[model samples]
Target: MAQGQSDPSCRRSPPPGGRSLRQRYSGDHLQRILLVRGLLKLLLVVAVLAGATAAGWQPATAWWAARNRPKFDTLAAEQGDVIEVINSTGTIEPVQSVQVGAFVSGPIVGLHADFNGEVKEGDLLAEIDPRTYRAVVARDKAALAARRAELERGAARLQQARREEDRSNALAERNVASISESDLDQAHFTRVGMEAEIVMAEAAIEQAEANLDTSEANLGYTKILAPVAGIIIDRKVELGQTLAAQFQTPELFVIAPDMRREMRIFASVDEADIGQIRLAQESGKSVQFSVDAYPGEVFEGKIAQIRLASTTTQNVVTYPVVLSTPNPELKLLPGMTAEISFQVDRRDGVIKVPNAALRFYPVRDHVREADRVILDGTALEADDQARGESPSASAKAEAEGERKRRHVWVVEADGLLRGIPVTSGIGDHRATEIVSGDVEPGQRLVVGVAPKDD
Candidate 1:
């Protein structure tokens, strides 16, 4: 080769120690280029997948939320009668009950009355053994007779002393007896000893007579006479039962007086509900009750009295209320349980709404504080006057007297809901009377919204 020129094969490629660019890359260097190309392809695939996921995520989320959204429940305001009531439980009892018991202690020998036997006043119910009492009477009688005989003997002795004194005085006047003899006879007649003996004997006779009377009276008690007319519901003693009235009188029978007459019910009223109860006889309101035995039948009664005494159980205070009802057929029995209800107040033809509507609250996000309507009694009264419905003094007082502020939700022409402040009266728990409010009948109100699925 020349100094500045090379062979053609060498010039067409590279020098002997170097390589051409295509040949250099065609060796182990080609592996590095292939790796870079694979990396770029992987990056393009990742970018496509991320773009597709981003494009589809929003629609799926929206579909899930729309499928699970809760719906609202609403109720219509209505016109009806709303009656407030107080409920209680009571025990049936006779108007008059008498406990027949043994006044004296003895073995019962006979029974004239039994369970469910009707009897009259002064009728014999049972008989105690009267042998011992009869013996007592006999002994007292003998003592009385002896005392009477002793009194007679004392009188006879006094008579004899008087006769002897008279004879001695006559003999002394005829000079046939000594003055000392006459004086001794006179002393025997005038002495207080015979008079005193006679008086003591009479007193003894009187005491014996009184003791006999007492024994007889005690014997009469053994007959176990009924004090009042009634039915014998309980018999505590059988024949040959011994009653020992040591500390307290032994009960023999329980008498329910006059089952054909009226009956009584003793009811326990809770302190929270006691203010609503009054004597039905005074208020002319009837009380209705039902028994477990007669589930479908309702009996009527009148309040007799409200007990002032209170009883406490488990920190809950209650008072006893008495009610009376006629039992001409004698169907109501003693000790029967009665479910009682008393009418506290009543309002007719009033605009009313379901209690659920008054108790509903919208979700916090759905309501704004400014949209809430809260009206006091004065404001409600002014609204009523503006509407040409003038309220009475008593009605205004009743509204002001209430301590609770009731509210109900009413749906507006818009899709949103707003609260309406109201004065309510005569609630039956299922429905309530709307005394004064901006709401009207046929208005749709929200009762409750369906709970969220989550």
Candidate 2:
């Protein structure tokens, strides 16, 4: 190209080396601008991220705190008494059970009573066939009569003999008869022999009379009668059934006296709990119970006796406790299974709290410190220390020992929680008694706090 005058293509184009330099410079500028823009974008993103982190910190912390803070339900701790210990269990049984048995052996001719039948004293229960006994009695009577006749004949003979002996003696004395004949008559002693025979016959008659009385008495025994007024719970004999009394008297009936008057409940207390049972013949203290037959219903009774006899089964020993209850309505029957609660102890108008309240623990240091402050305000006896000691140790020793105070959480007006110490008393598995504590009737106490996601 000419100087200051150039062809179109040549003007548009650069020198080869020059064009390469321009291309390189434009690429470098574009790269530098892109890098600078990228850096500014990175700085803007960093700033935005920093602002977001700053904005979220307080809220996230607050949410975490809210989740971890314990919440509570207010309860009152009132003064009350409680039974520290008691435990037992057993079965229901009748105080007295009578087995009615036959006195004499014979075929049961008739049955007048059966199971569950009410009866009175002297009431006829069963009868045996009296034919054989009657025959025996008749035979004895006939024997007695024969003996009486024999006695009378002997007496007449004795009278005749005596007269003869007297006549012989008189003849001998007067010399009207031969002396040898009088001596032979005296030797005979006819009256004395007759008198001995009559005495023997009278004894035989008396024996016969006694035998007859025995037979009659046996005959009376054939008619079975109730010895006491009661209800018949069981009858084993049937009409025409033969009973043998050769070895043992056959049981024919079982009776219970006056079901409407009273009933006994038998409960089996485990050996571990038996020590708590107190037996009394006349304890005014009452008990309540229910049977599966009568759901949701309650029955009342009084402690009657604690049986000393212990029964062991399958390596477990138990004692039977008996309670007497009036069955005036005859609602309770024999052999009923009962679930019973013996009023071992009771307390009223006492301060009580949910068991969980005493088991609560805090997470935050400030909250824990606040709780300590509240607990210190309420001074309570250190009974828990005593509990930790040996049971055999004296009460005074336990009282004087150092105790670790128990703590619970209470919500303050500022929505913060604080720990409060309390003295615990008699407690069931569900609730505990507050013997002494700063907690009021309506102040809420925390049980547990929910965990938060970090």
Report clashes for each candidate as comma-separated counts: 0, 16
State how far residue 226 of model 2 sits from its true place (Å). 1.4
lDDT of 2 at 14: 64
Q: Identify the runs in model 2 with alpha carbons over 4 angstroms from their true place.
A: 1-41, 65-90, 164-195, 271-276, 279-283, 312-317, 355-421, 427-430, 445-454
State each model's CA lDDT, in order: 0.83, 0.74
For model 2, the local distance difference test gives 0.74
TM-score of each: 0.74, 0.73
Q: After superposition, how far is residue 441 of candidate 1 from its true place, in Å?
A: 2.9
Model 1: per-residue Cα lDDT over 237-275, one tens digit each: 999999897778999999989777789999999987777
- Lowest summed lDDT window (length 10), candidate 2: 373-382
lDDT of 2 by residue, 96-158 (tens): 678888778889988999888889999999999999999999999999999999999999999
lDDT score, residue 13, model 1? 50
